[model samples]
Target: MASPLRFRRSSERWNDDRIIEELYSHLDSNLGARSVTPHYVGPDGFETRRFEMDNGDMALFTWNDDFAYWLGNTETPPALWRTSKYTFDEVPYQIARWGQRELLADLTVESPWLAKYDYLSWFFLPVLFSKDGRETSRAFFRKYDAGFPDTTRDEALSFYERFLRTGALDDYRYTMASKLGTSQYFDKNRMSSAMSEFTVAKLLTEAGYDVIPEIEVTTGHSLDFRADPRNGSHDQSSLVEVTRPQPPTQRAADTPVAALRETAETKSNGQLNEHGGGAVMFVDCSGFRDDEWSAVVGEQPDVRHRPAVVFRARPSGAIDAYKKGSVPLSLSQAVEWV
Candidate 1:
């Protein structure tokens, strides 16, 4: 699959006239490309050119004598686009810096709706502006409150913006942000499920673990996180898999407790069962309202799996949580341990 944003490093010497001609020819033919003034000026010593097509596809070529870089969402060019892809942070500072400015300009240059959620726009820039997801992702934030029910769009944006500003998930920006997806239509379930991972990351960080996401294990699947405890003597990694129960109104389980149990049981039967053992299950009830959460927390229903955390978080930075089985990590920082 073509990457949402492509960043490539080329060592074939673009400073030479012959190479430059070949590059332009390939882009012009494949992408119906025409050069325009780059919206953002790159660092000194870098020559930058921006291209646009009738379809709105864009490609940026920037290079200095020592390094040549390509950042674009256009169709794959001949040999250059086939080169390895680099994440936004993997490229050299100058190129990455320019890419941020250039890409952000490309993303927000015309979309006035995005202006208010500056932090969210920047945090999810890769996916929010991706070729396939640009419309749907933005719509989710703009119209759907990013799937947070009973909340205004601005409130939802503020909740996420505040958390993202903490920079806790900066290391996994691409993987995590892309999880919000680029599908043609907005899916509340899928988008909210993706955001659940971010909530789990926040919980894990507050609980004092060095949180690493998308951890690979013996099972073919990738677990959501591997958090190392920072306690004075112990050094064991804990794998956490997160699942979010649909709000009671959205699911057949009309009661909050039933919804939480049914949702967690499905996960226990599927991915967690496949994971075999030694992983913690986190059932997030953040989508629930005061009464729904009151019911679930009041009952403290068992999620069918031990070593599980059942929690609800408010946008106000409040968390009510209960654990089943012997949960190994300390979570007193943010969770009230309800």
Candidate 2:
């Protein structure tokens, strides 16, 4: 696998002209799948560039203030892909730094020959940031777009299944969220649920819990995850069910906060009852009233097994594991479970 050329901010003196030459030279040499050419270097000191990807689609970027912001596709309107930026000091193109590490492994398994150019992450960045990022990405890379090029729904599923056979779960997640910008599959409520689950899953993984998504327990019941505690070995595994109250936009103009809490509780109760155990329920309290949230958290789930503790996921990503809990855990705290 080829390693993408990495750039970092350094105190070393930089020759602007020489640096631009090296960058363009590197792209031309490394990008075997794409034709990279210098578009123009503006007098204002920003360098504009264009890339024609493997599938013949083109995108543009400009390097300014040590950051590269994608302009847009060759012919597409700016209305689709918002201007997304990448800094030279950080891993380029990826929304999260952790993704860079995973990307290397993905490239090894999927396209080892392309590994050399993986560092040219910008080659893939624009499409992923656009409204139809996923679609454009798939099209540009010659991957099967879910519903395009006259492919039927069944054929699309087959392509999806094949891809899922090797694609990482996190990739699926990132891709799904990107695709949701234009997908019909996720409406308001479903999008809320998806976001809550994704947030909790990310936090759990950060906290060193071996978390699995949508682990099925019974015939019709699937919990969000069957999580192993911080330590690799644990006597008992935990089933975690996550839910979020109505999003701010979805709430009725006249709906009281109490009604929203009730709605959240109902969803939590269903999971607790079906799971019938000490499964922990994580409720996202993003838009719930303060008093309503307190009341909801104060009440416990009544189940045949032991009662469950309801944790509130605050708007700022902090976790209130329980009412009056002393030790609050940050999303990235993975050393030990709080």
Candidate 3:
């Protein structure tokens, strides 16, 4: 894969002269230079200018609303006030530093690439503050607006490519909550559960496993949470069964377990009669309780087989595995199981 590209600082700088030159180059052919005039500079360092297009339209630019306030003066010179009544309202078009930052922040929140390369802040400031600030701002905004959809399309394509290469796009999505107007941290258990399931399914599909989810096997009238359809023919079939948080003790006698076992046995027999015998494996993920495990084995179990995996509720919160003599799985260990 290619390394990520960086946006250069030198490419982002903008100044008054450069802005004026660019605008002149753009408008010169249509509106002759003779029609353009430099008026006055403001106390805040913004240049006020006026221009007449060849088509006879007039426009003005200034830093603050001083020009507008002056034009409203009843005693002001009629010549100045005459055109002042026609003055373009540049105050609304003027960009403040904070406003520019806010705009960049909004864009960064939506487009990961902008934030990824740290180019949003550099790009927005000049566009919002240059001499032709209004035009620059409009152009920049429009460019991003037009490009966003394509950027999103490109991201989707990239995710698909990664999926094909890695058999899983584990980091493609995220979820979070908010409290007191602040974003709450992710719940690790919830995130792990979702990611594990998604990654497993994606990998299986990529591997040509003919995977199915929540499949209903007719022989035992049981719903298999997941299955690989390619494992068997009509008479004989092999399948893997997964159980999570083993049925609660309250429902220990649920018929699902019996039904699953029956399906596996029947499928094995059918396959054996038709071709050869097949094996079915059941993976039980009912993690052990710390206290129960310690009482049974007299010590803590290995980190990989810790029981906290079964009862995890929040990813950011700690589990009390110590109470039951069990331990939580490390991230690396969890990934291995997945």
- The candidate scoring highest on TM-score is 1
Instruction: List TM-score per model, in order.
Output: 0.88, 0.41, 0.22
lDDT of 3: 0.30
- Please report, in order, the local distance difference test score of every candidate based on alpha carbons: 0.80, 0.43, 0.30
List candidate 2 stretches off by more than 4 Å: 1-189, 202-208, 232-234, 247-257, 265-278, 289-307, 315-317, 323-338
- Judge candidate 3 at residue 301 and give its lDDT: 28
lDDT of 3 by residue, 1-338 (tens): 11111111112233446435643344555555332443333335444444445533233334332332221101222223334222111223332232233334534554444334333223322322222232323332334321112233334223323443442222221110000011122222232222233333443344344444434454443323243434332222233322232222323434333322343344334532233212222222212233332332333222222122222211111222221123211222122221
lDDT of 1 by residue, 1-338 (tens): 23456488887667647444766667777767787888878778888877787677777888777767877766656768557888888887778878887767766666656656677777787786576777778777787776666777777778778888878788878888888987767687888899888888878777777788999888799999998875653357799999999988998998999999999999998888988978999999888888899898788989988899999877767778999999888788869988
Which order, best to worst by lDDT? 1, 2, 3
Candidate 3 global Cα RMSD: 21.9
CA error at residue 38 for candidate 3, angstroms: 37
- lDDT score at residue 90, model 3, on the 0-100 scale: 28
Clashes (N, CA, C under 3 Å) per candidate? 0, 3, 9
Model 1: lDDT to the true structure: 0.80
